[model samples]
Target: MDLQYVNFFAVAVLAAVIGVTLIVVHLSQRKLRAELTQLREELALWQKAGLHAPRAVAAAEPDARPSQAQGAPMAPAPQPLSEEQIRERLQQAAGAGEAPERYRHVVTLADKGLAPEEIARVLQVSSAEAQQLVRLAEVGRKKS
Candidate 1:
C-alpha cells in the first residue's frame, strides 16, 4: 500500500511540472505575437502618412505642355552688345567712382567663362546681378 501511494505522488508531480512548462511557453508565444502585430500597425500607419510617397515633377512629363492660355507673353530675347560698348559702359561707371569694386571683378570673371553663381560668390554680388553681368559679357564676346 505504501509503494502505491509513492508511485501516485511521483506521477502527480511530473504532471504538474509539464502543465507549468506548457503555460509558460504559451504565454511567451502570445507576447511575441502581440509585439509583431504592434510593429505591423506602426509600419502601416507610417505608409498611410505618405512617408514613402512618390514625387511628381511637371518637367518629367514630355506630353504635358505648359498652358499658354494665361495672357502672359514670353519675354523678348536680350540683344548682344559689342565689346567696345561693354568697355565703354564699365569705363563710364569707373569714371564716376560709383561702380563697386565687386562689380568689376564679376565682369572680369564672367568674361573668363565662370558661371554667374560662382562669380557672385567671388565678387559678393547678388545672384541676379551676376547673371546679368554674365549675359552682358556673353553678348560682348559674340560681338567682338
Candidate 2:
C-alpha cells in the first residue's frame, strides 16, 4: 500500500473518532440540561420551604469586635478542642464521604409502606437504593 494512502486513512479515522466524541458530548449535554431543569425545580422548592444553607459571611457585615485602644491588653487564647470535640465540630466536612441518612430514610419509608419509587422520589435517591433499603429493613424485621 502507498504511504500517502495510509496517511490519509489514519487522518480519516482520527476525524471519525472526533466526530463520534462530539456527538456523544452533544447527547450528554442534553441529558445534563434535563438534570439541570430538575435541579432548578428542587432548588425552588427548597427555597420556598426555607431549607437553604446559612448565608456566607460577607464583607458588608460589620466586625463584631470593636477596635481596641492602642494599649489594650490581649485577650487570653481559647483552649484547643480535643480530638473528639474537633471531630464533632467538623461533622459533615468536605471529603467525609457518603452519609447513611439516605439509606436509613429509605428503610424508614419502606417500613412505612411506601413503595421503592415513592421512597426514591421523596428522598431524591435512586430506585435501586430504595429497593435495597427495603430489603435491609425486611431482613432486620425477620431477625428481630
Candidate 3:
C-alpha cells in the first residue's frame, strides 16, 4: 500500500510539472499571435493610406533639351563682385562712415562662405549677433 501511494504521488508531481509547462507555452503562443495580428492590422492600414506602396511615377524625368554645346567650352557664371569692384565698394563704405574696423572681419568671414554659427565662434558672439552683422554688411553692399 505504501508503494502504491509513492507511485501515485510521483505521477501527480509529473502531471503538475507538465501542466505548468503547457500553460506557459500556451500563454506565450497567445501573446505572439496577438502581436502578429496587431502588426498585420497596422500593415493593412498603412497600405490603405498609401504609405506602404510605391507611386506609379517612380521618379522625375530629366529635361529633354541638350544642356551643353557639342564642342564649345562652357563659360562660368559671373561673380557678384570683381577685385576692383570690391575695393571700390569698401572705399565707398568707409567714406560713407559705416561701422568701423571692428566689424570688417565679420563681413570678410561672411564673404568667404563661413556660416553665422562659425562666424560667431570666430568673433566670440552669439549666432544671432553674427547674423545681424552679416545683414548689416549685405545692406551696406546693396547701398554701395
lDDT per residue, candidate 2, 54-85, as tens digits? 12234223333233465545454345445455
Alpha carbon deviation, residue 90, candidate 3 (Å): 50
Candidate 1 structure quality by residue, lDDT tens digits, 1-144: 699999999999999999999999999999999999976875564465444321233223433333336554544434555667767776676578665444545555566667776665544445676776776555545644
The ten-residue window of minimal lDDT in model 2 covers 53-62
lDDT of 3 at 20: 100
TM-score of structure candidate 1 = 0.31
Off by over 4 Å in 2: 53-144
Pairs that collide, model 3: none
Candidate 3 stretches greater than 4 Å from native: 51-144
lDDT of 3 at 11: 100
Better of 1 and 3 by lDDT: 3
**Where is model 1 poorest over a 10-residue stretch in terms of lDDT?**
53-62
Model-by-model lDDT, in order?
0.61, 0.58, 0.64
Best by lDDT: 3
| TM-score, prediction 3 | 0.34
TM-score to native of every candidate shown:
0.31, 0.37, 0.34
Of the candidates numbered 1 and 3, which has the greater TM-score value?
Answer: 3
